[model samples]
Target: MLKIGSGAGFSGDRLEPAEVLLEHAELDYLVLECLAERTIALAQKEKFHEPEKGFDPHLEVRVRRLLPLLSNQKTRLITNMGAANPEAAATKIVEIAKELNISCKVAAVTGDDVFQVIETNHLLPNDNPQQVKKENLLSANVYLGAEALLPALETEADIIVTGRAADPSLFLAPQIHHFQWSMHDYEKLGKGTVVGHLLECGAQVSGGYFADPGKKEAADLADIGFPFAEIEEDEVVIKKVEGTGGVINLQTVKEQLLYEVHDPANYFTPDVTADFSKVEVKETGENQVQVTGGKGHERPDKLKVSIGYHAGFIGEGEISYAGANAEARAALAGSILEKRLSDKVPHLRIDYIGMSSLHRTSFGEHTPYEVRVRAAGHSDSEEVAALIGKETEALYTNGPAGGGGARKKITESIGVLSNYLSRDQVHPKLIIRSTDNETI
Candidate 1:
């Protein structure tokens, strides 16, 4: 059985170390999906401070621990930890392996960073002049597909390191390399894609978000489990890693089926088309959910892409006030500021939202009043200066509430980022392992 597992954790310290989490759970292959817009920006910030830091600082630590586990030949890994510099990241892993005297090859797959190349080739549309910027381009990641990842896995490297590949590729690459699934094997590829989607979120498919129908209670989710996929040509099975603390029931499988799926019939990826609606999940045992009836279609020629850049100075400020009209006063304060700033900078857009008693029920119903106001905008530093100029007056307003402060323009930048089709007709190259440890 080819057991595929996904790892979960935020960019920072919010998540425990992978070694700590995977200590009990056993798996054949481990995949990490680590790309989000916020994460990319955070990675870029680290890159800015130390030019060597291209990927998340946390990933390097995780990989250092993951390598020794893989020396047993039972555990291999594919991770997007490569972030911006897959080659450099791979070199680091190889060094770690050498230190342990372990024989393992690190394959770095790249060619997905399309930020500079996109601009130089004029791949961005001219009509969207607002998006084309030279300075504010924060992070540029390409939505790579499985085709580019196959060669790296073919080398049978200990770990496949990559930048921002499509979320499904983490699951799909293993099937492509193991079964030698052809580029056009839509039937088998679709089954593999479904397996990938099933296990992509780690713990989600293991009942973190599922509701039980038999009992009027949630799954015993604490120490919640991560997903595992067992694949074959005629069928596939979904389960959780052994000794983990979650259930895999019919309800949980259904919930995972609906997560982020755009279309049921045409669930498309670069690998294969997954017919989600036709899928049937049956509880065959205590923790195993039998998966069958997955159908397929042809893959797309062009890969879908995701891009982001610096979008000026967008910031948020929050302050609490106590009074009966606290909510109203906060609203009025934001309104007054919006009108004043709009008059000052015609093109400025102000967004204010209340994040307090307005949405929560535990604010002691009626005895008190407090509002948390957050405002954000994208404009020049001069515009931010104009907005901050009026904060004192808003603070002193004789409005309904009393004793509140304003926070304005916490983050500022003038770069507008966007994405588009790369019309330059460049072939995305996939290199297995470079001896020089240099970027291609």
Candidate 2:
């Protein structure tokens, strides 16, 4: 049984669902994904709020809970939730395994965090000004692709974890570990990589984000299912845990096929080239897709990184009411707000949220009969609050757009922002690996 299991590195930072899978599936391979540029920014925000929080220190606790079960079953796990701190993540895992008397080897894939590495190595990307702006990055992570997994797979690891490797690599690493696949097996490797992508986002392929018109009876979304893979030499079967609820159908598979994936022909990752168009997904049973016919291409020399930048401070606030001509009045009211704020504090960058009349007022199809117009901004000066207050009152009267009553500001705080920076190249060293099968 080429059994595979999935763990979503979703925002809650909880692994309760994944732990449940380990107890039930007796999984041979576990894939976890936790890297998104947005995730990094969120981690940064958490760190900024509590400087000592450092990173996702809580994921380890969840993993520790599963260690005992994994110890009995000997199920190997791989995850990319080690955001911005793989070493720290591994250290915590090691500590847990040692205490539980469960022998496990932990491996980490580094070289993804290039924010500081670039400065030390003087490795920067193209000379484009915008690309160069990445030098000022608050965070830099190369969606490093698959190269990060090679070292860990080569070691004795029962549970391997990583951070910021591509979403699919979480799936590909297991293939590399089990088959000992070579980097150059473009065709077979590519097929394996494609299998990983299909299952990486558990719910996406299981009808959470997409639905099948032909298979209405196939859905059980209330308890949405998670994806799993049955691996073979050249193909994989996509299914979910037995008791879980959800549907995996053609439309759902098709939607996940193109989600954020640009250039299906050249879908790049460190592992193998995955050709989506060449892939065929057939509903083999309820909650199942027999995936095959995938082809891969040559891997790229340089890794692609996900970088983020501090655009500027942005906030939103508004007031709503039920009355006739509400949309128009809301628009006018928003304009009045900006005018008032600008008159009082001209230098402050002012914008009315719902008042797109300052721009294009396309309210889509069902325009709200009773809506709201809000204003917000970012200024390097102390006049920010004053501008907000001034605009709040302007909706009552005077200015280009006018409405009624008092306005509101959505209370929020924006601080040090981040961007991405890529290095031209680097000499990555060996980290450890997970030890499910060890040689003395």
Candidate of highest TM-score: 1
lDDT of each: 0.65, 0.64
- TM-score of the candidate numbered 2? 0.79
Candidate 2's error at 397, in angstroms? 11
Off by over 4 Å in 1: 9-25, 41-51, 99-103, 126-129, 134-140, 209-217, 344-370, 382-409, 412-440
Off by over 4 Å in 2: 13-16, 41-53, 97-103, 120-136, 211-220, 342-369, 374-424, 432-440
Residue-level lDDT tens digits of model 2 in 240-312: 7787766777777877878879998778776666777788878888777888887888876666655555444
Which numbered prediction scores highest in lDDT against the true structure?
Answer: 1
TM-score of each prediction:
0.80, 0.79
Worst 10 residues of 1 by lDDT: 9-18
Q: Which digits, one per residue and each the tens of the lDDT, describe model 1 over residues 120-188?
A: 765554556665465555666566778878877767676788887777778888887778878787877
